[model samples]
Target: MANQRGLATPLGVEFAPPHRADRIAALLAEQDRWSPADMPAIHTDTHLGSAAPLLDHLRALKNLSPKAAALRDRLLAWDRRMDAQSTDAAAYAAVRGAVVRRLAAHPAFAALAAPPSCPEVLLPWLALLPRIAFALEHLLLAEELYEIDRSAVVAAALEEVAVLAPAAPWGQSHRLAPWRALATTSDDEPGLAGDHDCVPCTSSVPGLTDLSARGPAARYVWDLARREDSRWVVPFGASGVPGSPHHRDQLPLWVRGDLVQVVTDFEQLTKESDV
Candidate 1:
């Protein structure tokens, strides 16, 4: 029963940590310093629905703010260019590589104090940083190229996927998707199949259009003699004070299928909030 993790009868499964993508997320989570060069993280956790906001941004094609319009125009060009390319994975990846280089310089992705940096821009890239560890080990390798970072390919390919398949499928609607997908689900930890990997979606109703509207009301892990080891999380965050960075902070973890560890330790809990 004794092990590095503590005392417990081992189950057949073991859970590991997920990876975080953006450096700006560190600035948001720990109030770390910000640099203009760091591109913000936007829904990088979910390969499927997280980029839906970017799609909506392009829908109002006319009268968008200067930055929004600027970004849209470039994406449109990228969209056309991406579609004309060959399907060989190498060629597909090369196109993305070129597109992302341009994306890096665009104004829409400009680093700001918080999101909503662009006028009339629905997705505030800066404020939208979701500081959650994304477990890339679960992504489907069959259809993806290993040479490129997942986020980079997604950035290059998103416009194409959105323009080609514009519908936002929720919950069980994932089954209808052309590629493999999973519902907003919580399976017993330590054993989620790679193809069936799910996000921490609390509102997984069949027809909902938005995942952010709902979340885990609360989450918990109980510990006995050493009460400090117990952890808890509310829907978003526990920065109970108004406008605390932590108030809406834990959401990314919750959505990306992970949990934050809260210490009840007057009991000296080994703090590992590495989400």
Candidate 2:
């Protein structure tokens, strides 16, 4: 799950508590245990963080309750099943099935056979970008085809976008834009200067398809070691509603690779629970 939902906006999905990071970690470790010894080829630098959480859980797995261990192992097994997407067709199916069994079993996924197009419209919404944010390694790195053939990477990337495009409203608005934390919102197009054009170069991972670079609506990085070191930004801006003046305010920061520090003080914030 992504930390899409918060006090500031209603158009994003709420993230699972920090404890949930272990689930992904356990699954990845299990995946490595079962997968072939050959390292799968990777397509881009953008996906390095995919399996990072698993490192934290490996030690924890040794001393865990039965329930915790089982969950972790199952997730690991699932990762192994999906590790081979491009060259290994059999492995892909296994992983997909595991996802259906695991993710679909959740009440939230069950209620919506199809996740909402936007996170704001559906609480705990299971959408594309959030899923990609966690599984980027698998999609871009773990699979061998990611590096061998550029065509394969492009096709795979398009498949992901197609999955969520239907549900996404005005999703095309993800073009590069600037973010204003305290400035007034406006509908006029902002000038693009010195701003990295996320359209192709920055957004698209080199050697991969342009579509592959187009990520789900937003991205963020939180460095827990230091509160000030933690920085965040979205493809659009502080607001999620499209056509609103506040919409797409953060485009410039994202394109420029500039991130705003997370404001921990609750008093200095906007609390809008619902869109």
Candidate 3:
């Protein structure tokens, strides 16, 4: 909505906004005059600034368990970026997932575990675990009503994470797994860099799988100043046919976060009769 209103620009990075409208507005004002050449910076901005609050909260807490302390120190030392090769991101995600799961299972929240008598479409809202997983930050900072020992959960989760070491980097696990109508085996899909709140959002359900099943199906940068200067790219190619020349031609570009120039000239395209 902000993009549509010219209050912000869509760089094809994050899907859900961080709810920081004021901050985004400031950023928009700062980059009001950005040109098409600056689009690359927008596309590649994968900083995890949104996670700072949670990190700061964790650091300020006292009497953390050894494992939790170690995890906190490692996260604090991190560059605060969710780069593809970042091991810190992987560790952080693992610990966060554990914390969320443990919190959801607490006796205080047991009442919420029962499925609500709502319509099937609204069933997800009644799922207690996912609610905790998605709104972890809020729950962590919010006033505790149910008297749940959040700190204990965090520590236990950290200890568990330390026991079960995740060897892969963030990108190796946090990959883009596009759903295909026809089941096909291919290892060409690229591992992505970014979290649910990062600029380049490659969100996944923590403690489950890091493979992102949802994202921009197609990315585009429309040059309102000059339509001919616009650029776009799809995950695959122009053709839907299995063995067509255009099939999967754009895969390489999409993986690299590159876009192709939009061709508006009909004369440049060959006629079907010619083919």
Candidate 4:
């Protein structure tokens, strides 16, 4: 029942953002009014990397608001008066060292012999950017995040956030869990970015663990004319018992975006009598 939470609708809903490129293009004429004008019809160039072109976007709307008086004073110290307000990636080169050192401690990061800096990173105004350090970590680790082999990150998504649930359940136990696959989808990029037909979509928000984060909890295809023809799938399986065959049986199907038909016919479903 926990999965059945939030602003879900009873009627048919379009999963993708509905705005068309042409309509959004018109709105964006004034101020690039619909910033995601190129989206949905086609995914954005956004990705988890310092090299993305989106970071070079030059626009601002109150990028910084709250800060300690002393900190603000320090930024304005030495008779400096105004902030440069350059939104470009390369402008913040001076302060990238601290982040580089922190990531260097990770064994996976150290093994690569990566450069001290990824110069393509930028300053952004997202709420997560300033409040959370992992966003910066992702920005700094963009190079590695793009790689094919992410076996080490299967259990390492940072420890700052809390995971709660029934004991040994996925949300609680996934921290020590292993990863069988890695989907290219990410926060800045839609899951179905390159291949719209692809079934696997492993999107994860930055500054958070990749496992059990956010995605569709369940998928359903209700057949209106024939009720039993309907099909559905959940992230886990049917049996709650840990070692049962039915336990986690549908996990592979769920990961592959497959569904199980509804057992509406009384005779087809298991009937508990004397068993």
What is the lDDT of every predicted structure here?
Answer: 0.33, 0.36, 0.71, 0.32
lDDT by residue for model 1 (1-275), tens: 11122333265354322111222243357645432222122211222222223333344445444543444554443322111111221122222333333333335435532445456434422232221112222331235434334444344444443344322222222211111133553322221100111222222211111122333356555555455555555645765443557756765554344545555545665543554
Each prediction's TM-score versus the true structure: 0.25, 0.27, 0.80, 0.33
- The Cα RMSD of model 1 versus the native structure comes to 19.2
Q: Write the per-residue lDDT of candidate 4 for residues 189-269, one digit (tens) a residue.
A: 111221111122223222223232333456666667778777777655676555557756766565445677778787777
Worst window of 10 by summed lDDT in candidate 2: 36-45
Q: What are the RMSD figures for all models against the true structure?
A: 19.2, 17.7, 4.7, 19.2
Worst 10 residues of 3 by lDDT: 1-10
Where does candidate 1 have its weakest 10-residue lDDT segment? Answer: 189-198
Cα lDDT tens digits for candidate 2, 96-151: 22332333334443444555766563422245334543343344334452233423
Residue 168 Cα positional deviation in candidate 1, in Å, after optimal superposition: 7.9
What ranking emerges by lDDT with the best candidate at the front?
A: 3, 2, 1, 4
How many clashes show up in model 4? 1
Top-TM-score candidate index: 3
The collision pairs in model 3 are none
User: Candidate 1 has which clashing residue pairs, if any?
Assistant: 19-133, 19-134, 114-127, 115-127, 116-124
TM-score of 3: 0.80
